[model samples]
Target chain A: MTNRTDFPPPNANQQAFPPPAAGNQVNAQNIQDALEKAVAPKVINTSNNKNDGLNKCPRCGSTEISTQPGTGMLVCHHCRYVFEVAVAVFKDPKELIGEAIGTGAGDITIDETQVTIKCQGCGAEVVVNIEGSMTSRCHWCRQVLSLENQMPNGAVPDVLLPFLLSRETAKQHIEAFAKKRTFYANSHFKREFTTENIIGVYLPYMVVDANVHCDIRGKAGDVVRKYTVGSGDNKKTYYDIDLYDIGRDFDLAIDNLTVEASTDKLNVNNKMNTNNIINSILPFDLENAVHYNGNYLKGFNSERRDTNINDLRGLVDAQVRDVARFKANSTATKYDGGIKWESQDMDTKGSQWLSAYLPVWLYSYMQVKGNGQKLLHYIAVNARTGETMGSVPVSIGRLLFVSSLIEVGLLFLVIIFFLFLVF
Target chain B: MEALFAQLLDSVDLTQVLAVFASSDEDGVGAVLLLLLGGPAFFMFTYMRYRNTDKRHRHEIETPAEMNNLQQYNNFIKHLTRQSSSTITGANDNVVSGSLLSNGGASKSFKAINDITKNFK
Candidate 1:
């Protein structure tokens, strides 16, 4: 909350650059003024450039803009103005297909870790270290500078899904989730649990849309005779089935298959952190995602895509195969007895991989058991759909004790019934 | 042959059987009432028999109709699959990849591709 500066004397650029606009209708001059306010005030660099991640407020000339809580538009802190960024659409299906099956890795492949941007307010050069961060506070003027443009390092994605759940709403959801599991939850966990400690994060993911052609060959069965053999204690049931070769070929159009772009988050091995808890909250509204703007990530934590498209291609293919199998199996639900798929082949005719950031509010804990083993637990709420999921550590002894009491009570009732019947 | 026929007729004793019922005793009336009323036990047994018979008849009528409906649904799925084959032929030429790079402009052809692909799923 400190707004003090010791780097340099304040200049004209340090003053609120663009005065608030008089009315609602924004024009070319307003945007130019906003850009000038975001960059050096004296420099006139006008070249019709695209604003992929840079967000400047045309109304107030304030760079302290963030995604308005529970809304899709960005709000300027200085002027209380709301606005939206233009989303890019891929209209060509063929282009998607090529990129899906493309031999190249992906579109943006930069590996730079640092960049210097000149402060628009004071004409001061500010070096921003983006090693594990997306935004930095200006050292001289206390202005928040964010990654506002697309770069080669793949730090910025093509799309951004702003948070729809505010921090307060997320805290309430987390508390309610923990309250339900408190009966068998470890006492230590209950004592230490705090929803205020939650962090809002924008995790990286790749949204894939595919036009697939599937060919499935398998053997299915029909139950002809379902009869019991033997009698009483020796009785056993058997099924006599008739099997036949079945094949199906169909074209499928799939939209929005999300895969984790970070390697650490994708690792679901329970021996480590509760990584599966995050993966379980997936399936964001990729369809409604808007263009990327660093302003959306101003107040929250963010991660860059470390895993490449080629690295996660196998996972995507497996997901496509699973979906295709599910569709093919729909026709065979009539085989109530049982059906087995011997083989299936899915050919990807077209697929498009797009990069985006999805919002999540997460509260994580490390639950250490009596056996000296440590386990991580997380309760996460999806920012867009408000879907929540978590793993709560429970006391095994407590559960066993409750179950045993119920079993003893049932046994006592059985004894009383037998005694009454004999009398 | 006449003596043999007489012997067979005498063994019947029709008058002896009539004397036992026509004596007008109380036991004879009771026996007649038992045969006429048939008792609650006998009625219950007969009612259960009819109910079981009706249940078997209803089951016999329903089994075949359920089997026929399942078979009809199976046939419908096959028909749908067959009809979809024709639509697959014209899809190859329309196959194209969508791009975020060209998102700034509104291309009618791209919108057409998106519309067509969305319809298939």
Candidate 2:
């Protein structure tokens, strides 16, 4: 392999391209040959055609396929045969080279909402709205038909993490959270809060694995002498610090860094909505994500991936830089005073992108203030890890009144002590 | 017994104690001001606690297990001396702190990783 630094610089007087020779003057044949030599971007094909059109039980061949509660497996209603989608295998982060993207992570060039599938049971055609739902039941034969293939509109993803936490368990988690904050909660929110409104949802996320090389240069200081001078109000402390130049270079392999793909959920405006509450429950168990199967989404609602890989390049770059900075801290432990990073550079040697749906149980409430200003609050539970977090509207007036009372009580005690001292 | 208790109480001069508190000194005024500000402080504390419940788990980036091809360089540059009222105890003091000169928009917690590094160093 040739190192990039070993290459010689181009001469200033040299023509970028030699004047076209007699037969090579920009012709269609030359252009065609150049185009043929160009290499297309690498793609990791994750498409499975066996379960493409109509999904049926391998045993009894029933179309009634649904996920079993508390278990990450699909079950047929009639035959009761339990199975799961094939697990997706990806290359190790260190082995990743160049830019490889999963087929499902491709750009959404088409705005498609409706897809018609020919029912295998009664030979009837059914239209499944990809926007609203991916699975539909045929009216003529009553056989369930699902859209299993990856669509260009980003409705379907490469992998799906089935819900492991049941609705009942999620409700209990939300209830316990709300119970703790009931006292400071707004009056209207308290009155309307209910765990029954919680619904299981599959949120869109873009999972990335990258091979990165980082270099950081900074200045660090070490205290050589420390002493105190003067006394009373004039007391002062002084330090003689020795500064040093520090530099670190390392290679880091980052794995399974997930980012929200939907535009609505990515907008985490604290004032307008509690969307960040959803983002707080990160780091789902993406390693267990199965191959794309519509049966996993039978009873749950899902949000589609609106943003493509290009749209998320900025976010991925920033996050990768953060990870690099964090990795360099381990080797920089000798810098006692602290390191102020003057320059940080991270080069992405290779990266792979894949789209997936992660499960979450969400409960929301609208708190309307006396002035008619409203704020939406959310309580989200990670269906995989059961990690819960939420925002509750606070009753500012009530809280202030109680705090005032506490202050008055302290003042009364002070006055009583003074009186005792005087008498 | 009751008479003895009364005599013991009268032995101490309560007027002197009262005069000490009523002198209107800096310490006395400062104590009163701090007490008066307690209510507002409590209000703000409780408000932030209930409002930002989602920020409890601040660690969004997972720390990697290992780093490869590690290379380190450190060269002594010069010495700096400064005088101030603030006490400097150890290397972790405010005088010798680190920050990101570039990419200022990075999370404040990422900068805090420097503080964590100080523990091991």
Chain B structural similarity (TM-score) per candidate: 0.16, 0.34
For candidate 2 chain A, the 10 contiguous residues with the lowest summed lDDT are A1-10
Tell me how candidate 2 scores on lDDT.
Answer: 0.69
Task: Compose the digit string of candidate 1's lDDT tens values, residues A340-399.
Answer: 555555655456666778899999888776656676778889999888777676654565
Q: In candidate 2, what are the lDDT values of residues A1-423, reduced to their tens digit?
A: 111122121237643223333542557774454344322447777768644457888899888999898997899999899998777889888765567788888999888889988888888888888776789999998889998778788988888799999999999999998898888778888888888878888999998888776767767776777786676555556777777766666667788888788888766555556676787788787779888888888988888899988667665665666667756655656555666677776766567889999999999888776657677888999999999988888887798789899889778877886798799
Interface Cα RMSD in Å, per prediction: 31.4, 13.7
TM-score of each: 0.64, 0.78
Against the correct fold, how does model 1 do in TM-score?
0.64
TM-score, chain B, model 2, is 0.34
Cα error, candidate 2, residue A360 (Å)? 0.4
| Predicted complex 1: CAPRI docking category | incorrect
